[model samples]
Target: MPAWTDRALLCLLLAAPAGLFLGCSEGTGAEDVGIVCDPGEGQMCTCASGLGSVAWCRIDGTGFLPCECEAGDEGFGGETAGDGDGDGDGDTGDGDGDGDTGDGDGETGDGDTGDGDADTGDGDGDGDPILDQACYPGPNDDYSVCFPIVVPAPLPAGYDYPAPYQGNPNYRAPVRYLDLDAIDQSAQVAANFTLDEFAQSWKGRYAVLQPHAVAYVQDLRDVVGPISVNSGYRPPAYNAMVGGAGSSRHIYGDGFDLDPIEVPLATLEAACSNNAGFLVEYESHVHCDWRNVDVDVGFFGLPNGDAPNELPLLAASLEQDPHTGHWSAPASGFDEGEPVRRWTAFAADDRVLTQARGRTFEAPPETAYVEVLVGARMRLVGEPLSRRE
Candidate 1:
């Protein structure tokens, strides 16, 4: 090697070591590097071991210090934690295990790590609102029963009867009526009552007051007798057998028949006036309900003219005709030759009374007699009438 080259190489090696030593030399030694970081200098330095990395420290306390450069791809950069120790237990679950916070129930899931307590006394089933475990809101209204009175808005035209009112529970009548007092049903439900005893006990005259007819009679009381119940839940087939095959509503639980007492249907209707939905008379009986129809049934004269409408059933006029259990309704407009009888017991006040029937199998033109039921209202109508339109 040339003499000049050797000297230059030796000088370069020595300088490189000197630079490294100075840069990495800041130590915790008290007297060591008084080199402090100075903001004015816009530069600072840190120790190689990162002894005081909080920031902006220096060697001589004020002059511009060299910048310490750490490796480029370092993962973490921060002050190492002190040796301080707290409770060693790393259990991080909430007090309770319900997965809920604060309202500790004591159940803890390491993965689901939460307090799992369920019964929180909150109406919502969750202890806390934010942590409410319940999904749906509770029912604010009734969840269990049909109210004592089932009412639909926009009442129907006539009375809406659910099933035959098992009648008021407290109601009872005479032996002639049913001997309710004799049978002592003031407190009982199904008395050992027979159809005959039920019949002989009829103060209301008609046998429709038979079986259940008697029970219905008790409902009328001194108000009147022969207060027959013509149609008390008859099946659809019976209405069909009786020529009601066309518009029979017996299929639905919402149908019933009304039998007039002594007056004419016109009088009963006139009494109702504009409120005529409840007093509609068909060939057989008065159709009293609350729902109105698009077409009035009066044209067929079921409520008035006999024109082959339905029947004109009479409570007092019932005979032991061979049709014992089943009796045919009389034609509209009684035959002039046929005897016309007057029922007084079922009549009272300025008002008249009548029986309730199912369907009538006659046409119109015949003047149907009057059958007025007392207490014009109060009858409860159940389900909708079958759409027999």
Candidate 2:
């Protein structure tokens, strides 16, 4: 009825959406005034002695309804439920009644069978839940039961000896040199073999075991019950001392001369033909290495249980963009809906330099190599890239 109320109603009519009313009022009392609003619109306001609450516009678009505070609001209308015992039973007191079970003993009130044990059902009488078998701590603190190969720092004395071994321009030493002193010889590197079994007996202090090579041996073990590692890593100097080939895979840390314990030598050699990149048959043992095989991006960090063919294939290749000089990893062989690319750059010393979530990466200065992992099942290591100036 007031002049200001008429103006308010006119404003609301202009602002209301299609099919919405413009004006509303209470009964014809002296204090009653016209209110303008859009139906179903909400606004925040003070209520219940200045507590925050929300008021919604009436369906008729006339006035704002009274503010209603939520049930949990302090000093508001609704009653706050008491903090019951967290036993998850439907009670709210110390006793096992049907009411709210406040923090009480581990009785029926707490959803326990009065056994004082929580509902974890671990069976150990402790309330803790049992972890998955896969989550149990392993010898290597990794998913695999095998221990990780340790590569010691500060190259040992006489590591690059015999001058010619290091003087050859084409000669490249093993990327990873195991520190026998730091390794647990008794620790399992596979199901049957120990780290000590792989150490170079000539030095007894340093060794190498390429993960893929180790994986190959494990695959052989799966086919045959168990195998023996007669020879594993051989340092360049040791290789020469033992009349090993100048380019022997042992110097690279991937070669192994294995003898099957349960199967015939011929059967073990046959298995190596399918699993190894190269194999040489001898009267006593069969020599195998992954030197000629393409990198198995998926097999590097995984547990050594599955055969090479059973593992996922991630045939990724690194290419440099001539225009931008950035490296991009394009890959295939992943299962449907399974591609999640991650790129990592490593320095010459095997230190991680940087990582990218995408397929393309801008190599940092002094980047030695790039690797790409697709999901958790596939991985590919790119060929060593030329160092950037």
Candidate 3:
């Protein structure tokens, strides 16, 4: 027997766990020496070589298990199952066993067991316990996994829905909601304003509220009595359909197009002028919102639904409606028209002209401007300029 052959057998015996003697020579049955061959599903079979080495291969339902050694150690006078060059250190094996440099791990898959660079070759990646799994795409893309979306909770009490949005499917945020049509009268949101009256005609399915804006409405009610809302919380789709402002605060559930049901429009406008928040008085209705920023208040009349005949030189508070052919004024309306005249007019000392480019023309130091428009559509022409004395 070669001296190296004796050393190889000794190494295999030492490496075996417990008192199991994996070293072998001749026809020693694997089961006789307690070598188990129970390769379960999705697993490969492994066998010990004649020289105490191992061989690993996938068991593809063939019922063919590697239970015996191929041969003893070549130089030791027996055929060895390991393809190693017979010194039996298990190094440089035929790439089929759990030798130090063998290809197989003596298990299924790649066959390499708990040895260096000898894995099941399953692409488990580094075999690290923390990161052995495959990569996952994400909740949005991966439909196989269930992911939860965060939404505001604690919806308002007694708020029922129509057939479609009932029970709040798809997990959308819910605030206070009121359906005037479904609910009874006398349950007024304010004086002369009931959910059945003002909110009953709301086109949108939901009516959310920002607490601050609600408080503003309450305050306005104290001064001007009952107020009616023409428009309130509008969904993005509905807002776009109705040609609402692209950046309208109504979409954010904090704005309202309102009108005085009992009090005069001027009285409501005057009350808004003395308070905080945004207020814009149109010909009929008053647009109010709780922006919580600088208090911006303005007044403009929509006498007709047509473009202004003459564009104002200094007073540029005239705008044309593309759909209705009506001329109206909105916040930042001056920037839309071309400056036709640059005249001065007598204005109150406290009057402030808000114009394009955030420019403020004061009445005391600067003259107030009044522009008059003529014609059917009120298209502003360059020829005539109206100045107020």
Off by over 4 Å in 1: 1-226, 245-247, 271-279, 293-389
Best-fitting candidate, scored by TM-score: 2
Find the 10 residues in a row with the least total lDDT in model 1: 5-14
Ranking by TM-score: 2, 3, 1
TM-score of 2: 0.36
Ranking by lDDT: 2, 3, 1
Scored by lDDT, model 1 comes in at: 0.24
Q: lDDT tens digits, residues 75-189, model 1?
A: 1112321111112111111123232111233222222212333221111112121110101111211111111111123432222223211221111111111222233222211
lDDT string for model 3 (176-270, tens) is 23332333434434333433333323455444433335446657877888887787766555666676644455654556777888877767766
Going through the candidates in the order shown, the clash numbers are: 76, 14, 30
What's the TM-score of each model vs. the native?
0.20, 0.36, 0.33
| lDDT of residue 307 for candidate 1 | 19
- The runs of at least 3 residues in candidate 3 whose Cα sits more than 4 Å from the true structure, single-residue gaps closed, are 1-192, 195-202, 293-389
